[model samples]
Target: MSSNPESSSRVDPSIVPLMRSLALELVIYGPIVTIYFFLVLHRTNNWLTNIFNASSTEYAIVAVLLIGGQGVMLEMFTSWLLRRIGLRH
Candidate 1:
């Protein structure tokens, strides 16, 4: 169960900032999701809510989109951050 730091080429120092940014994204996502649900509920006015609730697939779709959004946001943010910091490869 011993590990060697030099054996791992997958991680780079530049990735540290990106990892930090992703952590920040997770912190932000919670509030964003909460607000998004409230807005959806407001716009749907119970009809769409009931429709989504009646079908697990619909709810699952929402969950997928939410997670996808997080992933894309992390990737794009990291790429943009790298470019901004002149760390792009």
Candidate 2:
């Protein structure tokens, strides 16, 4: 049998304020995150070009690194921003 809805990841209706705060944070950070990633990638564009010509194995490795690296950096940024603004998650 399936677990109760409260245990699910879906947003709970009782925490509208929390949801609003998160939505507000995303609105503020979306552009910043996108630009930061773009600038970081732009600075190492020669590395990017090399990757495009890489073998499949190398491409897989680079893909994992890029995704994981960006995810960690963005998560850290979001955590710092939220904490700085006194939002607790």
Candidate 3:
């Protein structure tokens, strides 16, 4: 409804940094997470299979714990990485 077309097309300056940070995080996390899962799956395939075969309930609990622990560890690692790279304080 506004008369000015330029104003509608303009991006907020404050959002640029946030977008950059998000892009950087995605770039950093993508390969690390992929390699992490690759290694985990490769190394733990047999062990996890055994657990699943032994008891579904136990497997479910262990799977949840592993996922939660992975999330915590990855977050910590990513935060530390960002600090080291001077992207975050």
lDDT of 3 by residue, 1-89 (tens): 55888787975667666677777888988998889778876789999999999999999999999999888998898888777666643
By summed lDDT, the worst window of 10 consecutive residues in model 3 runs over: 80-89
User: Sorted by lDDT, highest first, which candidate order results?
Assistant: 3, 2, 1
User: TM-score: which is higher, 1 or 2?
Assistant: 2
The residue pairs found clashing in candidate 2 are: none
Q: Per-residue lDDT of 5-87 in model 1, one digit per residue for the tens?
A: 77787655577776766666566656866786688646756665775779989878876886798779767865665566554
lDDT of 3: 0.82
How many backbone clashes does every candidate have? 0, 0, 0
lDDT of each: 0.68, 0.80, 0.82
Q: Worst ten-residue run, lDDT, model 1?
A: 80-89
- Kindly provide the TM-score of model 1 when superposed on the true structure, using C-alpha atoms: 0.38
- Superposed by TM-score, candidate 3 places the C-alpha of residue 73 at a distance from the truth, in angstroms, of 1.4
Candidate 2 stretches with Cα past 4 Å from truth are: 1-14, 42-46
Off by over 4 Å in 1: 1-54
Candidate rank order under TM-score: 3, 2, 1
lDDT of 3 at 75: 84
